[model samples]
Target chain A: MLTPLLLHVSILGLAAASALGLFATRRESPSMLGSARILAIVATLLVLALQLRRGMEFGGLPLVSRFDTLLMVAVLIVGAALSIDLTRGLSVLMIGALPVALAPLLFAAAIGMPDEHPERNLMHPAVGVHVFLTLGAYAVFGVAFVASILYLIEHRQLKARTGPSLLGMMPSLETSYRLTLRALAAGLVLLTAGIVLGYLYGRQVLSGASWRLDAKVWLTTVSWIFYVIVFGMSFVPAFKGRRTALASVACFVIVMATSWVASFWSHFHRYP
Target chain B: MELSVVGVNHRGAPVEVREQLSFEEARLPEALAELRRATGAAEAVILSTCNRVELYTVRAEGAAGAMESSHWLALQRGVPDSAIASVLYRHAGLDVIRHLFRVAGGLDAMVLGETQIIAQVKEAYRVAKDSGHADRVFNVLFQRALRVAKQIHTTTAIGAGGASVPAVAARLAGKVFQNLAQKRVMIVGAGETGEFTLAAFHERGTLDPLVVNRTVEHAERLIARFGGRAVGLDRLAGTLPEADVVITCLGSSEFCVTPDMVETAVRARRGEPIVFIDIAVPRNVHPGVNRIENIYLFDIDDLQGIVAQNISEREHELARCEPLIDSEARRALQELGEADVHEVVGRLRDAQHAMADEELRKTWPKLGALSPDQRQEIEYLLKRVTNKILHGPTTAIKEAARDGSTPVNFLEIVTKLFRIK
Candidate 1:
């Protein structure tokens, strides 16, 4: 009851925060949005607390059910946004971040939590690391995507000499670039960790399963390669603006598409 | 006290003449003491810079006090009265207040929006203030002037962005590429304008520029002054693709960078964005090259356009600050009208203005679809109505404040309505 109730409250809190973020953006008051951001973070923590309580009751990780895994990932995304934004004083990012944080929770609430499998050790600790790492990467990329959209807006307004548009509510182009680098680094580290953990789990834990032939494995590998190229582009001056923005969005799309494929079709990710 | 000013600025005098009229920093106290004794003014301040020397005073004797001080100024500098009179200008009454406000706001600056004058004036005021040359009236006046200056800057774009041509170009370059240290800049000339532009980029940490000039020796000379590889003009096509930014500043009449050359570079870059800044007078790059995708081309005229736009945008920002200045100035004058007015009306007026600003912002977007003229008209109407409603009550408050006898209920009513903190 507490878990579902907290999730519902978080969904409402995040939605309100998003709305307040819109208002604060136009007003150019970072402080107003800062409060709403704090509220959203508090709501996120409540959802996290609920997950822990559920984990205690069920005698396993908070990520037992599919809904719980989705929600857990959503928490990380919110956590990433909160930490980066609070540190940089980019409270305006909450305009994009709150909605992104809300999406997974809303979806999870809609679908209901998946039943836990009896022999749950197949959902191994290595698998948990992979899942958490992948989600951390996804959340970081999500922020970069929002930053790109803001970058385009700022670039346009500056080119045209319009004084203060919605982009004024966002950070400067230089700031967006800094945030993009942070996201890129986080994505690279987490994705690399996920790949390392996936390999070890496949070799030692699930030997002779023919997991190498799996569509999910190939798709994830392809996505990983794509991110690596995107990572290289961040260093190259030629790959800024819409190109980098598009690359980040495209890589994230692959992440989601393959996540769906693995959940339904592949034996590696899903459990009863 | 009646306020008056006597000064010679860049407009009224040549720099040589202004320098002659100027006061040395060490002798400021002696000059202030001498001026006060000569003019019989209650208080005085002397602001002396390369561009201007202004003597400000408040006295019981009014206009004669200003002349007496000006005469003293002339005698001290060993200049005859006629020589001083050649450049001297005087302001009395409200004009003195307006002049000081304009000086603090940077409107009186030789370069519009230059901020150094405010600091200079503040320094002058501080000296006058600490040494007992300036007392209550001068203190309130200068303090209010500084407040008005800060208010103007906070509310306007006038002092917001870089105002110079090279600074604008550097800012533009900064916008295109975030890490100036990483990106390669190519400066394709070895002249004054080229050196300045290159230095601006260098200042931004775009350290290694590939210099390409018609004469490789000149390019090498520039490379010695500013760190960069000297690429020969003959091999420009090969080197062009390596640079994220290409600045063409040849003094020659003909086009230095052609459409074909940019096309070759673009193809090499796989349509990567390249910023082309043509600072040359006769145009170094063909205007047709702007047709290329991912190419940003800015000439001197284009940069000047940005400068003009920024100035105009800053002016728009100034438009917002003007009314606030007027209100705050009037409030200052009101307190001057009666010393008790500050103790009574200060907090209440601040609260009311805050409420006005908050409400205006909340309602601004609702009127967004209307034309600017229509919106401005509506704003005027709103301001007129609010001012009209407040005028009588404010007058009564000031009247009540003449001897610290403001009705307690009047304060309570306003505080309750506005929820004044």
Candidate 2:
């Protein structure tokens, strides 16, 4: 319960710090920006620690339920990101990294809790492999999605020729797009492997019921298909830049919607 | 004490006037000597660059001396006193100190935080010193100015983005292609902007440059600078196929590099990344070249947009540097103030010692008649009297020094009372 309390407060603090950073950046206040960066880093770490604790409690390992696993993944990504950013001595990114770290946790909260116990027959090593790889891909996708949103916002401001804002502190357009492409490429590979493994594991475990289309299974498959199209087009000789960025944003929208519906079903119907 | 800077700059005067005021490098040493001689300047440094010519001089006596020096400098430049006098900025004491600090710190640089100005100031100081013009006061002032410049460079983000259009172009190129050393750079023109880009690319060492211009001679000149070869405009179509980076700075009415030509080049290079930088005002490269597969084209507008953004970013960070400069400025001022006080006190103490020595010489024969013990006792009593006589004046002088009141009147009274010159 205190884990949830700490997580909520830390998220709120991150939000408030980002707001302050934005305001300071707008008003061109250096001290305010410095303080905002400090607040963002500390609060992000606090929330991450709470998630790590919860992850260990749930699974003994960091992965058990999808909820625990996603929370743990988000924390690790942000922690790694901020650590890299810290070396560059750019405090401006602290505010940029916060909401990106917070999105997954907030999404997890909106989704219902995982089942306390379930049938053990579906939990084979192969199935577990499939689940973990897909989860990992989704985590990478989450990072790409966050970066894409920032890229679009920055690109718009640049196009409008507006003055300096907090958004200007983000990396250049090409860097963001490259990061998203790399993330999506890795995620797509894992997703492909995961889907194949799941299909193979399902046939072995559930026999005739393996072919019975579950909404979650179809939704995941559809999102996976969109990612394939995105991954394929990205490597096309002419389709590397603005077209690739558009595809990534589109895939993100698809991934977000499908995941939302899956969480909805899991909450209302107690479906895995 | 008074200080004055009288000169014309690129912003204030036309090239004809600025060049007239400009001190050629060969003549600078003699010019500094002449400046000191004509004005009876205690300290001076003459900063002469193509963009600006400034004479910084210090006269410890009064404003009249500084004005005389400014007049001399104007006369040397052959400009009428009334014509150039309005732009002549004069300051005494603290204002002069602040103005120099700002100039040396790059706060007053045309391109903010440009490193060239500090070196320029040092060169001017050296010339003055070589010509026996820079005295102790000017030496201290210029040394402190250089140190403040170094401090700002190391401690703040003032020099971030390198404070130049070329550096900005290099940064943007790095972000786009991620590596410049492996790329081939083709310059479509041999103008000033093209030369700047060539320098940036050469500095990054990521690309082998190829210069192509309308005239082979013009292309040859730019190519020679980078130790690269030149080609005619006819070969640009062929060279475009192999170049990883193409930069155009030809101020042409029509496009020199077209989309159809780039489209062919992209196919020829397969899917290799190509970056096009157009720094020309009239846009030398075709806008539609951006549509070519695996080819990224950014025009002058785009690069200038980035430059504008970078400038604003630096300006935002300037807010952070403002307090840093103020604190450093205050520290510098306090140090100079204290040094002035110390100098005045040292002179006063020396004058006191001279008077005491005179009095002792007169009384030594009278004291010889006393016993040895009595003689030693009398000497101690005389030393005590000397200390007692000097104590109040020394304390008042030091207090006035820190209070920044110069203590000139008090110093005069003490000298008169002690009969010490």
Q: DockQ: which candidate is best?
A: 2
User: Every model's DockQ, to 2 decimals?
Assistant: 0.07, 0.13
Q: Candidate 2, which CAPRI tier? A: incorrect
lDDT of 1: 0.75
Q: Which ten residues in a row have the lowest lDDT in candidate 2 chain B?
A: B58-67
Structural similarity to truth (TM-score) of each candidate: 0.69, 0.73
i-RMS, every candidate? 5.2, 5.1
How big is the positional error of residue B96 in model 2, measured in Å on the Cα after superposition?
1.7
Question: Residue-wise lDDT of candidate 2 within B1-421, one digit each (tens)?
Answer: 4455666666667777777778888988777778877776677888888767888876655324333766887788788888766655666555665667667777677777777888988888888888877876678778888888887765555655534567766665564554577777888888897798779888888555888888888876776678777888988898887787788888689899898888888777755667787888888888787666556666666666666765665576677666766666566656655676566667766776667678877988976677878867876777788778778877886776566566434444544565553
Tens digit of lDDT per residue, candidate 2, span A1-272?
Answer: 77767767776877787788777655545678777777776776776677567555544344556565556555655654565356654344445656666776776566634657433543456755776787777767765665566556655554343433423346655566777787788788888898888788777666576353666777888898888888788678677655677778778777867776675564321234
Candidate 1, position B113, lDDT: 70
Q: Tally clashing residue pairs in candidate 1.
A: 0
Predicted complex 1: DockQ: 0.07
